[model samples]
Every structure is written in C-alpha cells, then in structure tokens.
Target: MIALLRGFLWLTGFWLAGESLVVLLDLPISAGVVGMLLLTIALLLRIGRLEDIAAASQPLIGLLAMLIMPGVVGVFFVADEFAGQWLAVAVALVGGTLASVLTTLLLMRRCMPAAPRTETPQETSS
Candidate 1:
C-alpha cells in the first residue's frame, strides 16, 4: 500500500509538471503525454531509477485493462458512427502505423552508433 502511494505521488508529480509545461509553453500536447515524455527523458538521463517507479506502479499495472474498459465501451457504443468513416479510419490507422515505424527507425539510427564496416577480399580484384 505504501508502494502504491509512492508510485501515485511520483506519477502525479510528473503529470503536474507536464500540465505546467503545457500551460506555460502553450503546447498542443496533453499533460499526460508531456509528463510521460519528461519521465522518459529523465530515465534516459539516469536522473531517476525504474525501481522507484515500478515499486509503486506494479500494483496498478494489472488493472490497466480494467481502467481502459470505459474507453473501449465508449468506442463500442459509437461503432455505427465509426462505420461511416471506415476509409478515413483505415487511412488514419495505416498512416499512424507507418509514421510510428519510421519514427522508431529514425530514433534508433540516431541513438545507436553504426557498426564497423568489413570489406570482403572478393572485391579487391576490381
């Protein structure tokens, strides 16, 4: 229970920071998203350890599916409305997936150093 409380505190603190950034910077992004980005940056920079977060959040992680039920149900209720925009939906899904893949590739390329090159002797004759 204490772990849960600490995790919630950490999550809430990051969320508040995200909200502050959104309000002060006038960003179009959501507070939650901004907060997550901030958290990622901090983790990458080794400013915080994952164990500190996992200790608190691990308890709630199992309930993630239950937490999303309302959103899933809302979408189900609007299924008919969405049917009319199947083409648009398809486009958005495909486009978003493509963009995500490309973005990941770019980030990996930028963050990871290139492998050392090796030349085969078969090409030396030319």
Candidate 2:
C-alpha cells in the first residue's frame, strides 16, 4: 500500500511537471505524451526505479486497458465524420500502427544485447 501510494505520487509529480513545462513553453503537444516521455527518460536514467513503482504500475497499466473503451465509444459518436473520411482515417490508422510497431521494434532491438550464436551441427560437420 505504501509502495502504491509512492508510485502514484511519483507519477503525479512527473505528469504535473510535464504539464507545467508544456504550459510554460506553449507547446502544441499533449501533456500526457510529455509526461510519458518524461517517465521514460527518468526510468532510463534510473531516477525512477521499476521495483519502487511496480505495484502501482501494474494496476495503472491494467486500468489503461479499460480506458480504451471510451476511445471506442468516442469513435462511435463520431461515426458520421469518420465515414466521410473513411479512406483517410484507414490510411492514417494503418500508417500510424506500422510506424509505432517499427519504432518499438527498433528501440527494443537497440536496447537489448544480441544473444550469443551457437554453431549448428552442419557447421560443426563442415
């Protein structure tokens, strides 16, 4: 419980800091995105340890899955507009998904060290 509270407060502080920076800079980007970036940087720098936030992180991540439903509902509400721009929306969705997947894969590959290669039986025989 204490760990959870600490995680929540830590995340809240990160979010507020990002939002404040956005307000001060008058950037067009979303505060949430900024907060996420800040959190990622903090984690990379070891400023925020994963174990310290694990309890809250687990529940918060799970809760985020539920939050997607609201986005689906909003899409339904804007169905007419979407239908009118269906092709453009489809292209954007496909492009964005591909870009995101590629970016994630690239980042993971770069961060993770290559596994040691083992010689196959054919190579040994050769």
Candidate 3:
C-alpha cells in the first residue's frame, strides 16, 4: 500500500511537470503523453525503478480499454466534422500504424543482441 502511494506520487509529480511544460511552451500535445515520455526516460536512466511504476500501473493497464472508451465515445460527438474525410483518416491511421511498426522493428533490431547461429549437421560433418 505504501509502495502504491509512492508510485502514484511519482506519477502525479511527473504529470504535473509535463503539464507545466506544455503550458509554458504552449504546445499542442497531451500532458499525460509528455509525462509518460518523461517517466520512460527516467526509468531508462535508472533514476526510477520499474517496480515503483508497476505497483501503480499494473491495475491501470487492466482497465486501459475502459479508460479509452470515453475518448472513443467522445469522437462520435465530433463525427460530423469528419463527415467527408474518412478516406484521409483511414490512410493516416494505416500509415501511422505501419510507420510505428517499422520504427519499432528497426529499433529492436538495432538494440537487441543477435542470437548465436547454429551450424547444421551436414556443415558440421564437413
């Protein structure tokens, strides 16, 4: 319980920092996203442990779909604004997904160590 409280504190602290940055810069991005990026950088730098975040995020992850449902539903309220641009939206979605997948694949390949190659029996016998 104490750990969960600490985790929430850390998360909220980062989120507030992100929101402050957005307000200062007048950027047009979600503060939560910026906060998450900051948190990821902190974790990668060993400034924070995954266990701390996991304590809070594990349950949230379980409810992710439900959490996103409001945003999905909200889109319907603005559906008329997109009445004639569905093809553009579809193309953007597909392009973005493919770009994300390709970027992830390339990054993983570059970051991960290659597996050891095994010689076949025939090559070994020769």
Candidate 4:
C-alpha cells in the first residue's frame, strides 16, 4: 500500500507538470499524453526507477479496457453524429490500428537483439 501511494504520487506529479506545460505553452495535445511523454523521458534519463511507479501503473493498465468503456458507450449516445461518417470512421480506425501495429513491429525489430543461427543435423554432419 505504501508503494502504491508513492507510485501514485509520482504519477500525479508528472501529470500536474504536464498540465502546467500545456497551459503555459498552449499545446494542442492532451495533458495526459504530455504527462506520459515526460514520464518516459524521466525514465530514460534515470531520474526515477520504474519500480517506484510500477505498483500504481500496473493496476491502471489492467483497468485500461474498463476505462475505455465510457468513451465507447458515450459514442452510442451520439450515434446520429456519425451516421454518414461511418466509412470515414472505419477507415480511420483500421488505418490507425495498422499503423500502430506496424510501428510496434518496426520498433521491436530495431530494439530486440537478433536470434542466433542454429545448425541443422545435416549441416553439422557435413
């Protein structure tokens, strides 16, 4: 519980910092996104260890689907607004998903070490 509290504090501090930056700079991006970017930079810089905030973040990560439910449901209420834009929305969703997957794959390929080549029995015997 203490660890969780500490983690939450770290997360909240970054979020507040991000909000402040957005307000001060008039950034068009969401504060949460800014906060996450700041957190990523801090982690990369070794300003804080991941363990310090993992406790708080893990639970939130688990609740991701549930957290997104409200937005999905809210769209239902405004369904009429999307009546004629379904094709565009579908294209955007599919394109975004493909782009995200492609980006992940490319990043993973770049960051992960190459696998060692294994010799087959025939090659070894020869």
Best by TM-score: 4
lDDT of 4 by residue, 1-126 (tens): 888888899999999999999999999988899999999999999886689689999998999999999888887687797689898999999999999999999999999887556634457674
- RMSD values for the candidates in order, in angstroms, are 9.2, 7.9, 8.0, 7.8
In model 1, which regions exceed 4 Å deviation? 44-50, 79-83, 87-126
Q: Give a tens-digit lDDT track for model 2, residues 1-126.
A: 888888888888888988998999999988888998998999889997677677777898999878788777776687776577888889899999999999999999999877556635457664
Model 3 residue runs over 4 Å out of place are 74-126
Better of 1 and 4 by lDDT: 4
Ranking by TM-score: 4, 2, 3, 1
Sum up the clashes in candidate 2. Answer: 0
Report the lDDT tens digits of candidate 3 across residue range 32-79.
Answer: 999999999999898766787789888878999999898898887887
lDDT of 1 by residue, 1-126 (tens): 666676678888899999999999999999999998988888788875577777766767788899988888787677787778988998999999999999999999999877545645556787
- What is the lDDT for 53 in model 3? 76
Per-candidate TM equals 0.58, 0.63, 0.59, 0.68
Model 3 residue 88 CA deviation (Å) reads 8.2
lDDT values, one for every candidate: 0.83, 0.84, 0.87, 0.90
Model 4 global lDDT (CA atoms, 0 to 1)? 0.90
lDDT of 3: 0.87
Q: How are the candidates ranked when ordered by lDDT, highest leading?
A: 4, 3, 2, 1
